[model samples]
Target: MPVTVHFAAGPAAWREYHDHLPRALADAGVQAEILLTAPDPAAVDYIVFAPSGEIQDFSPYVNCKAVLNLWAGVERIIGNTTLTQPLARMVDPAMTESMVEWVVGHTLRHHLGMDLHILNQDGVWRNEITPPIARERPVAVLGLGALGRAAGEALAALNFPVMGWSRTPKNISGIDCHSGDAGLAAVLSRAEIVILLVPLTAGTENLMNAERLARLPKGAVILNPGRGPLIDDAALLAALDRGHLGHATLDVFRNEPLPKGHPFWTHPRVTVTPHIAASTRPLTASAVVAENIRRGEAGEPLLYLVDRARGY
Candidate 1:
């Protein structure tokens, strides 16, 4: 019997994933019927979901074995009371590569102070300002998941002393891993560049409050490609205003499109990117969705299953 899979990720995504998903399912050896719209929700064996999609309440899909998310971050949909199906977040290789490139590019930009030369081409040689090598710069990555791990590893390969922190302890070869309150404080103190890649949860809201921001070494830079609420906007503004922090390159924000009059846009020390750090590629992400459906049919453990208790 062919498994029934519904594409609930919306029209735009349906257009993108229509062919790719079917091909991926065939490659994964799954006998499945993909539907852009499931007239009978109870017949749906699997649902490919995204927060931006049409379906909000999942109660109608009674037989759905799993809800496969097309994006890594699930905070928006995780709290939905109607969703009882097993959820799996996308962990596409293309997305990871994009994230690593963004992190490394921005890290290098700040480390080498390239903006000074790029923006100010006033023929000022500025030979006196010599930036330190990668080895001499200490960097901290505040997440150890796929994106964080990949970014941290890339930085370490370039000889940047990369210290990583998570809610719990993690052991990676090149990263100096830390956990708990004391560990976080330890990493923040010495890191010249602090990268935030942590997920946003109740406990992590405003994680970078004024007190914690004050702990960072003077003139330290912040690169946040992670969740927006992980940082306190007021505290960050204060830090930059006092010159306690050097610069902040932010990709995500509390309100997206960032708001026209937002202080971050006008702030000289802040660079606001429209959350382009990483995007779920249809080709790679569809393969992941198909593999999970195959695993479900084969009675195997699903990949990248969301831990409901942890709220990731």
Candidate 2:
């Protein structure tokens, strides 16, 4: 019997994944029927999910084996009481590569003080301030997930002293991994540049409060490609005002599209990017979804399965 897979990731996503997903399933040797709408939820063997979809309640999907997410972040849907099936988050290779590129590019920009020249075109030549090489700069990456690990390793490869931190202890070959309160303090204290890539979880919300931000060495830079609420907005602004921090290059925010007239837009020390860090490409993301479906059918362990208790 062919497994029934419903595309509940919305019309736009349907358009993006319609052809790619089916082709990926066929390539993975899965016989499945793809549906744009779930007229009969009970018959659905799997659901390709995104937060934008109409299916908020998953209780009706009695026979559903799993919910396969299209994007890497699962904070929006993880809190749903209706979701009971085993959930798998997307771990697209292309997305990981894009994140690593963004992190490295921005880290270099700040490390080399490129903005001092790029933003200023005046005739005055300021060659007195020379930037240090990559090895001399101590950097920290505050997450160890697929995205965080890749970014940290790339920085380490560049000879930037890389320290990685997580809520739970993690061991990565190139990264100087840290955990617990003391470990976090140790990583933050010496890091000349800090990059945040941690997931949005209860324990991590406002992870960089006033006290933690104050712990950073004076003139240290922050690169947040991770969750928005991880840093308290008021505390960050205050830190910048006090000159305790150098600058912040943010890719994500608590309020997306960041309303006009927001202080961050006008803040001299803050750089707000429109959440373009990484995106799931159909070619790679479809393969991840298809592989999970194959695993479900064959009773094999699914890839990137969500740990509900941890809220990632």
Candidate 3:
């Protein structure tokens, strides 16, 4: 009998994410059953879950293979007491590529002052505007994990003098990596563009506070594709107000809707996007999920597994 798989993130997921994923799963010879609501845990073989979904009682699934997460960040579900089963987080290559493209494009856009050239209809040749070289412009990526590392590598490849700071020190092949207080300072001191890509862990909460914000180079650009809580909104706004930051391009936020009345919408230097930087395209995501399931059945280490102790 084919292994049963169920997606318990509801019907909207069928349209938004799972539409193309089933085909990828079929290629891997995995029979996935996508349940709109939580099913009998006994009959469930594999579960493709979202943190925002309705599956609360994981203790019932005695024969479950793995709880494969649909979203990358699993902070909301990591603390569930009944979920003792091994959890694997999503890490799709398509998603990674998309994120790299977005971050790189935006960095270049700001670095080159592309907007100014587009707005100039005067037809007068502005020859005095020579953009700064990437090597001299320091960029600090706050998280050194998978997505952050890839973004940092892309920036470093462009010779932007990339510095990656994570919760722990990570030694990358070609990047200047740093961690903790000293590392943070070193990176921020030289960084003309600062990107926040860390998760919303307790230790990382309000990571970009007033003191940290002040440490950055004056008139630095800010790009946040990570959790909203990683930055203190008040501190960021104040920095921008004081001309410490040139611009802020933010994708994710503390609230999903980002209320119509929020100051970010009207802030001249703030560019708000509805979290489109690192979306998990399920065609690639399903392949990752299926591979992990195959590894689970084969008694091998699952790929992209979340470490509960570290709260990642």
Candidate 4:
């Protein structure tokens, strides 16, 4: 029998994946029936899901082999008590490439003080302030996950000294890896520009609180393309207000479409991007989904499986 793959990632996603997914499944040699609505949930062999999807109860899909997430971050649905099936997170190459490009572009923007010239269009020549080259700038990446490692390596290639810290120790070829509380502090202290790409979890919520934010070298810039609650808003505003930190370029936030009254929107030192750092391109993302479905049928190990204990 062909596999019954239910596309439960929502209407917008359905529109994006409807065409690409079938082609990808064909390429992977998987015979699957893609369903937008499963009248008999128990018959579903797999589920392609997203946090915004309609299906909140996984108990109905008794025969489902695995739940394949459409996005990289799984914090939204990870704690669902009803979700018993094995889960896998998306790790699309196109998404990673987009993240690296955004990180590198902003890192260089802050490093070169492009804002100083761009914002100050007053006919005055600002050649007096010459920024140091990439080699002289020290950068730290707070997460060593796929996206983090990719961004760190890209910066490393540009001669920026890259230090990476993770929940546990990692040994990426180009990154100077660190782990544990002590390691985080060590990396934060020396970094002139710090990038936040850590996942959101109870232990990591408010990871950049006032105390930790203070550990950064004075005039340090922060690039947060990761989770929003990772940084404390009040503390960040305070740091920027006091001019202790150089600037913050934030792509994610605690409240997306950040409230009109929120200080971050008006804060001179803060750059608010509409969570556009990276996105799952349908063509590439569908292939990842297709590959996993193929593996599930072949009884091979599924790629990017999520460990519930780790809450990634």
In order, how many clashes per candidate? 0, 0, 4, 0
Q: Which ten residues in a row have the lowest lDDT in candidate 3?
A: 30-39
Candidate 4 minimal-lDDT segment of 10 residues? 125-134
Q: Give the poorly placed runs of model 1, Cα more than 4 Å off.
A: none
Global CA lDDT computed for model 2: 0.94
Give the Å shift of residue 48 in candidate 1: 0.3
Against the unseen true structure, what C-alpha lDDT does each candidate score? Answer: 0.95, 0.94, 0.85, 0.96
Q: CA shift at 181, candidate 3, in angstroms?
A: 1.9
Candidate 3 lDDT (Cα, 0 to 1): 0.85
lDDT of 1 by residue, 1-312 (tens): 999999889999888988899999999999998888889999999999999998898999999999999989989888999999999998999999999999999999999999988998898787778999999999999989999999999999999999999999999999999999999999999999999998888888899999999999999999999999999999999999999999999999999889999999999999999999999999999999999999999999999999988988
Q: Where's the lowest-lDDT run of ten residues in candidate 1? A: 120-129
How far is 267's C-alpha from truth in model 3 (Å)? 0.8
lDDT of 3 by residue, 1-312 (tens): 666777876567667765666776677666666555545768877888897776888998888888999888988999899998889888889888988998998999889977678768688888788989998788989998889999999999999889899888789977889998899988898899998988778888899999999998888999998888888999999999999999999998999879899999999889999999988886788789778877776788988888999988
TM-score, model 3 to reference = 0.94
lDDT of 4 at 146: 95
Candidate 2 least-lDDT 10 residues: 10-19
TM-score of 2: 0.99
Residue 25's lDDT within candidate 3 is: 67
Error of 2 at 84 (Å): 0.7
lDDT at position 33, candidate 2: 98
